[model samples]
Target chain A: MVQAAAVAPVPVPVSTEVYQRLQHFYARQMQSSDDLDVPAWAGSFTEDGVFATNAFPEPITGRAAIAAHCDRAFAAQAAAGIVRRHVMTMLTAEHAAGDGERIHTRSYVMVLETRRGQKPTIYCSTLCEDVLVPVDGGWQVVRREVRRDDL
Target chain B: MVQAAAVAPVPVPVSTEVYQRLQHFYARQMQSSDDLDVPAWAGSFTEDGVFATNAFPEPITGRAAIAAHCDRAFAAQAAAGIVRRHVMTMLTAEHAAGDGERIHTRSYVMVLETRRGQKPTIYCSTLCEDVLVPVDGGWQVVRREVRRDDL
Candidate 1:
């Protein structure tokens, strides 16, 4: 038998497969949010997910609460005929030293808002730090903190 | 001696190290352009690099020509007091069937422009397809095609 390194949680490099797997994960997660699919977007997170943003005074906890918050934004965007695209960039991911089920990621998200006959604008730019955990054969964001550049 | 794959240039998986290395490469390359450092930006490409964009009637061939083209743009942005940040997203890298030195990458770049005392705007969103080769222990873009989503 091979001896394993005895260490606690520390940043560990993942494989290329893991990296691309994450690319797909974010692509799907952000798409649901951009498409204003309330249930789908909420499903990207855990049942007890926590979302905190610099623009908001209080953190929105739990998947239902997060969904409620975004549902309103979605309706407003739809009413205004605005299409917002959540573009993910500069994503970096690492796993806990000893826990394969846990991963940490930091990504930059730029939201572009476009209206009919008008040029697209950078509605918002924020950095999202997420703590992800595997559940039911998929990954879910357990905690997300958004740092808005505008704020 | 170890056996090697006989394939020519197919999609080969890279390690996490290569993926992160590319992240750093783009971060530095885009920073130079955003800072209006024309020469520094040109240095990111090979001597015979080619840059094609739909906005231009003809492609810019060679690093010198590319530099000359961007130099004018940099001057104009400087005069207009615009800061354009190039944010890279959804980057996928793959190597040629058997050649380890040739790597192809497709990346999305979002350019956010900000003027003094004004909110930032999505100046441009583009897909950059690049062919990269190592030179003198560093990677240089040998060819690049820019596709603007706004076009």
Candidate 2:
């Protein structure tokens, strides 16, 4: 009979308050997209926040650029008569000891697109890595990098 | 121009200790599956824990049943010469005020399947809702329900 070695659990280094705030941020993120409020969606990040993905090798920096990017993205979807719903899940946040200023998180993002009288289809699925910081007593994303997982 | 109403963030009610434990439990859960340690994976749940999914209408209840189910599932995957990596993300834990005994969470789960000589493919993606409770000074899953997001 072979025995398996015991493995210790790794603790996610984040305070309860930070975890709750991040969850709230993600919820608002999803809601902004669902409501097609591009400005609000861009406001989720910091003034100089970065949004990067494999498709766009160059990171979209600053709130203005982010808003423009979202505006175009949302407009395209509307033109196609498609509704997009972004779902973020399996999020885990980590912070190093004595480093209370910033927190890192990883999550799975799925974009579901649907048109009238059509079944919803998954348009994109990616793994998102984020860095968040506190501003004005609330959490704001400073950087976000998305990598395709469905390749 | 129509102005969108300002949306206040909804706070997630959970203590720092409980949040940390749940994160640790999930980390261990992923590790157990990655290592193919069925017993350890099953042990993550409570004695009367229930694992239910849309695909499996019948819930697998109790630690023993969960272990058996995992054993068979792992064995089948091994026999097929396929490697399955379960990635959980966007995990959010919440508990109502005055409800300290049980905590609720929502996360996204993605399973990537790879063969010896082939590229990795996404096997499935689902949203998971979990109920956890403290037992023996650690968090243990009491109930897990999975809803498929990609069909």
Candidate 3:
């Protein structure tokens, strides 16, 4: 008879201050997306943050470039008369031992879209992997990769 | 002209110990689900924990009931020959100010299903709301509500 070994647990410690800061960062990110505030959305990232998605081959880097990307995307959604709500849930974060100032987090993202006088629908489901760093006394996303789960 | 007020930020603090415990709790939950270990899956919750879903009208309460629920669900999945990967991401936990022992968390849950040779498909997407408490020196989910996004 073969014996099964118990799995050892992995411990990840995140400070109270860091946890709150990261929560605020993600809250702002979702709020900006829902409100279509391109500037606020872009400002959630670091000055040289990178945003990449499976749909786009090239990654968008820098705060300004990210702002432009959001502007174009929001404009297209507006033209289509589609209102979007981004609901982020199931967020797990780990402190990066290699870099004390950084944290790595993964979240489940659902993009809900609604048309005028129509019911909302789940437009997309994605897994978001984020690398965050403390800057200016607050946490900012340094890199965000959106992987489409529906694909 | 009236100027719009700046949005005040919401602050939620979670301790380093609590953060790591919650991460482990979620990890175990996902691991048990993937492994079809009913006892381990149900043990992730409190003895009197409640499991509720939008799809199911009645809530499954207590450890025994929760275990039975998992057993039935996993059996059905096995019958269908579907292997599921429960990817939990975007986990944000806030220490409840009024309750020192309890924490409130929200996470994004994506269930991907694969057959023998077919590519994986997004089986379901949900926003999970959980109330967790420390029991036996480890965090256990006291209440979990699954809100389906793709419904």
Candidate 4:
């Protein structure tokens, strides 16, 4: 009898359905933010979801806090005569080892900003890592960590 | 007796697997060009692929022609003392009503440009449409059309 070698199991790529749904999830979530629809974007996260970024020192916990953070930020941008758009791409998703309902995803994101009568600028570039879960027949972000490229 | 009403079949969304694969495809294809890997990027098209854009009056058809066009353009950018990056997002994919092997996709694209010691700017923004087919186990572009959002 031949001895079998033990191999480590790597995470499988998410199904086509799951991958596409996540893409749509990100798109809608980002769009809502760009459109200044605070409730819409904030609702993308779970009630107790957390958002952390290198740009800010503190992690924002809970959907309500996330909404408040975004509201203030959007207000500041609006007061500065800036128009903003969020673009996300380069997404890769895989299933978690023991959870069929959980997925890990990484994406590249950029924020485009334009002032009146000015050329659009690449305001920021960041790498976003997210842990997602299925809730209420849709995907929700449980945790998000962002690392700014220019920082 | 009730007569059945005619229902038009709207294009169905492509499978999740296809959507994810295409996202990878575009990322690799665009990254090659941004890296000045001309041949690598050009291989993304079929032998008789067609790329048309509103910015150019003539469409570049065939793999060789597309490669030449890209080569010349990349060279020009290199000479201009600037670095360029391509970011594509907001992708939507649907299947044609009558074709199982064909997929139609639309995406938003932006070219980010930076000169030495200068801030990065959005050089162009466009809407890109592509007709895709699976060839030899991977996806290839059969046709593409681009409309500049800023123009």
Q: Give the candidate number with the greatest lDDT.
A: 4
Docking class of 2: incorrect
Error of 3 at A102 (Å): 10
> What's the TM-score of every candidate structure?
0.61, 0.60, 0.61, 0.60
Model 2 vs. true fold: TM: 0.60
DockQ of predictions, in order shown: 0.13, 0.08, 0.06, 0.22
- For model 1, residues B35-126, the per-residue Cα lDDT tens digits are 88988899989999999888689889999998998989999999999989998876767775567788887766778889999988777766
lDDT value, residue A40 of candidate 1: 88
The number of the candidate with the highest DockQ is 4
Candidate 2: list runs displaced more than 4 Å.
A1-136, A140-151, B1-11, B15-17
Model 3, residue A121: C-alpha shift (Å): 12
Per-residue lDDT of model 2, residues A1-151, tens digit only: 1233234324357876777667756865775775689888888899999999887869999989999988898898788887665778778998733465778899898886666555556789999998888778767788989998765
TM-score of 4: 0.60
Superposition error at B126 for model 1 (Å): 1.1
Q: Isolated chain A: TM-score per model?
A: 0.90, 0.86, 0.87, 0.91
Error of 1 at B98 (Å): 4.4
List per-candidate RMSD values in Å: 8.9, 11.2, 10.6, 7.6
Give the DockQ (C-alpha) for candidate 4: 0.22
Worst 10-residue lDDT window for candidate 3 chain B reads B1-10
lDDT of 3 at A70: 85
Q: What is the lDDT of residue A12 in candidate 2?
A: 55
lDDT of 3 by residue, B74-149 (tens): 9999999999998776566787755766788877676778998897876666668899887778878889999664
